[model samples]
Every structure is written in structure tokens, then in C-alpha cells.
Target chain A: MTSLTSLASSRTPADLLRTSATAVWIFLVVATVTSWALGTDHAFVDNTTAASVVVLLLAFVKVRFVGLYFMELKDAPLPLRALIEAWCLIVCALTVGFFLAG
Target chain B: MTSDVIDAPASPATAPGKKRRIPGEEGTWIFIFGDMCVFAVFFCVYLSARMADPAGFAHDQAELNQNFGAINTVLLLVSSLLVVLATRAVHSPALKRHAPRLLAGAWLCGAGFLGIKALEYAEKVHHGITPQTSDFFMYYFVLTGLHAFHLVLGLAMLTVLIRFASKPEMSRGQFIFFEGGACFWHMVDLLWLVLFPLIFLVR
Candidate 1:
């Protein structure tokens, strides 16, 4: 249904290198930069709860992206993939709740 | 639960109704899941302590080197990217030749992370900000110190892997070892992603 499916099905090493892994790396760099900017500006101080949520949300996104792609869990069985995603969601949510309500 | 992607002896002959394969042993994932649970408990303990003395924690956190933390984060992410590239490349006969170089590059990035970490630790200790300085420093050292230990172990594991893979052909078991190592390193990076923000940013 989508181009990514075609890309993923393509087994060429160059294709994999130039596609998902690169895309994930770019996203990670951008996310890190964004978080660093927020940290430097001290936005988290303006509203501690809101800032904590944003920062950790970004963290959650980074972790999930790496796990799914680099770890190749995208090709893993449904049960395993579900378990990994559930771990990410639960840990991120509870950690944020801890900081926000701690 | 693993694959012939890297060490097929030769590619598996196509057949209908064959089971799909995983790259590494099932045990690696199980071990990581347990390790993460332990770290989660550590995180909750740290937060509970921080909650009891938020101001003090914040004050100590401010003394940390954020720029160094940011650099280490990038280093680990780059290393992870290289490991994934190496893994994917192993499936292609045309590009498997490049996997060794990709792995070496990843090792350099990991080394860079540890170098910066050592500098950061030395700077703090020189300034008399050891773990004994406060509860904040205590958490900072214990949590990050444990993490740093894993980073060192990861680097060592990669060293062994790169050496093993230097052969013209790696065994299926060796490929699985490579995959498991990649997962472990990524977990290390994953831990730091949250740790960086929690300790250095989320004041």
C-alpha cells in the first residue's frame, strides 16, 4: 500500500543503508538537537510538568524508532513486536509520571 | 529463533511453508528484558529520592556537563546506526564486504563516547564533586557509573565481534552473536536517552 513496503522488501544492502537506517539516524539527530535547544533555553523550568512531558515523549519516540528499525523488530513476530512497544510505552509514561508528580 | 542471514553456509534453498528466522538467540532478548526491569527499579528509586529533595537534586544537576552528555548521546546513536547498517549489509553479497568497515567506524564512535565520559568524570572529581558531595551526586555517579560500566562492556564485546567477523566467512552462531551484541549496545543507548533528559534537562 505504500512505498516503504516496497523499500523494506528490497533486499539490497545499499537500499537498506540509504533508506530506513539513514532516515532513523537523521530523525535521532534532529530530536537530540531539539531537546538540547529546549534544555539550553530552560523551557522545562517555565512549566516543569509540560517540559518533562515533551522531553520524555521525545525520548520515547527515539527509543521506539531504534528498537523497531535498527533492531529489526519490524520484521519480528507480532507478539515480540507488541511486547517491545508495550515496554516503551509503559516505561516512558511511568517515568514521566514520576518526574511530573515526584 | 535465529537466521541464516549472515552465516547461511550458503543461502537457504527456497521452499514453501518455511518458518521465518530471527537474527539472534531468544535468550538475548529475555536477558535484556530482565536487565531493563532492574534499571527501571533503579530509575524509580532515583526519582523517589529526587522527589524528597527536588531543590537539592536540581542544584547538583546544574553542575553536570550537558554539552558532554549531548555529545555522548550522539556518539552512541551513530554507533547504533553503523551496527544496523552492518547487520543489514550482511544479507547482501555485494555489500557484505563493507560490514567490517562499518563496524570499525561504530567502534570508534563508542570509544569517543567513553573518552568524553572519562573527561567529564575527571573534571567533576577534580572539582571535588564526587559521589559523596550530595545525594544528587550520589545518584548521578551510581546511575551513570553503572551505565558507563555497560558501555565499556559493550565496547569490549564489539572488539571481540569485529575480530571474529574479520574471517572471510562468519558462522551462523557468530552472526547471532553479532546481532545480540547490537541489541545490547542499542539498549545501552536507549538507557542514556532517558537518563540524559531526566538527570540533565528535566529540572
Candidate 2:
């Protein structure tokens, strides 16, 4: 929560929203593109585990950005924010671990 | 910069140094949290199912078009972004008038998602793939179908919020409702973000 105030205060609510949303949007787009490339590229196809981990990890991070900004959890009550953070960490870790292990 | 400043006058709850407060009713978060827990269990069920027959699951997964999932991920993210803009716009007197349009755009993105999903669904059905087709198809349809149901609800909620938010005179109560709805919509998007990779991309 305390870590995110700097970037959010630069503009009016709308401008700040637009700025943060745009930043997240661009980051998501880049992550998706990278995932697509890694998913479809011939060389990467041979390494399914590596490709899967990379793409899934990218998705995990994108989820964090969405939760923090769009969900308005950055400034949420500490317990709520902590809950979300923990959920993300657990879900991502469990899913990736299961994917690789199974 | 430090936790001390946050506790100085604002207390830990307000974190005065942190200028913004979490929007919407705290009660709504309980629902959001509950929904997250329900979905987590669903994901676990999926993992268990996949582990039983990894080969079949992987084969059926390849049948899904990654391009579609990739496209929809961006679409949902953009929608959530627009909702964020609309929610925050209500906070600024100068930008209040623009909230409705931004929200409408967000709603349209939700519509776009359903449209793409329908097409994907139709293609699968045309190939004789259905929930009855196999275990993977069952999970695919059931999981995504449930998610689609949530997306529709999210859209309707957005529309309601837009109606009140766009008005020349909105109550503080209305603004809070709008914020809550926007958060719900983003939760829908967040669920999909996790679902997309788990169901479509991960090998």
C-alpha cells in the first residue's frame, strides 16, 4: 500500500487512473505478446516446461497489476491487501508447481 | 516513506501519507473474497482432473486456440482499465462528465469478450465438442461458462453504475455503488487472467 502512492498522485483521479491503467495495459500487452511468441515459436515449443513457466509467470504478474490498480486494493485495508497478495502468491505457486510436477 | 508517518496522525487504517482510500463498501470485499475462495477450489479441482490424465488434457488443450485466449486477455484488461478510469473520474469534479463514456467503453469490452467467446464456443460445437464430449470439454465449458455468467452480471452492474454515475447530480451513495461495481468487474477480469493461462496456455 505504502509502496504505490508516488505514481498515483501525479494527476486528477481520471488522469491518474488513465496513467496507471495505461501503464498496466501496456505492460499486459507486452506480456501477452511475449507469451504468444514463446508459445508459438518453434524453438520454444520443444521446451514446454520452460515456455509454460514463463507464460504462466507473466500471467501471474499481470494479475497483480490488475488487482492493485483496477481492483483498488493498493490503498485497501492492510488485512485485505495482505489477503490478496497472499492469495496471488499461493495460487501462482501452486498452479505452476502442479503444472510442472504433473 | 516510513510506516511511522502513516501512523503519525492518520493511524494505520488511513495511512495519511497514502492519499487514497480503498473505494466501495468493505462488505463487498467479503463477497469478493468468498468468490476468490470458491474459484480457488475450482482451480484445484481442475488441477486434480488434469493430473489424472495429463496426456488427454494436453491434447484437448491444444485444440483450444491460444490466439483467442491471448486476444481476450487484452480485451478484459482494457475493460478493467476503462472501469478504473471511470471509477476514479467520479472523484474529480473536472472529469465527472467523462465517467459515463469510459464506463460504457468498459461495458463494450465485456460485450466483445462474450462475442469472441461465443465464436470460440460455436467453433467447438461445430466440431462436435461439447461438455458431453470428454472430460476436458466438460471442464472447459463448465468453467468458462460459469465465468461468462459472471461477466454478464458484471456488465449489467456496470450499466447500472453508469446510469447513476453519468447523471448530472449523483449522490455519495451512488458514487460508492459505482466504485463497488467497478471493483466487482475487475474481479471478473482478474479471475479470467488466471483462468486463461491455466486452461488455455499452460502445457
Best by DockQ: 2
lDDT of 2 by residue, B116-188 (tens): 9999999999998999988888999999999999999999998898897767666656666777888899889
* DockQ of each model vs. true complex: 0.44, 0.46
Once fitted onto the true fold, the runs of candidate 2 whose alpha carbons sit more than 4 angstroms away are: A1-18, A42-45, B1-16
Please give, for residues A1-102, the per-residue lDDT of candidate 1 as tens digits: 111223324455557566566888899999997787677664435766676678789988998888787776776777778877988888887887788877
What residue pairs are clashing in model 2?
A: none
**lDDT for each residue of candidate 1 in B15-128, tens digit (9 for 90 to 100):** 233334554778998988788878878878888898999989988888888899999999999999888777665555556677788889988998999899899999999999
Q: Give TM per candidate.
A: 0.88, 0.87
What is model 1's interface RMSD? Answer: 4.0
TM-score of model 1 (CA atoms): 0.88
lDDT of model 2 at residue B3? 25
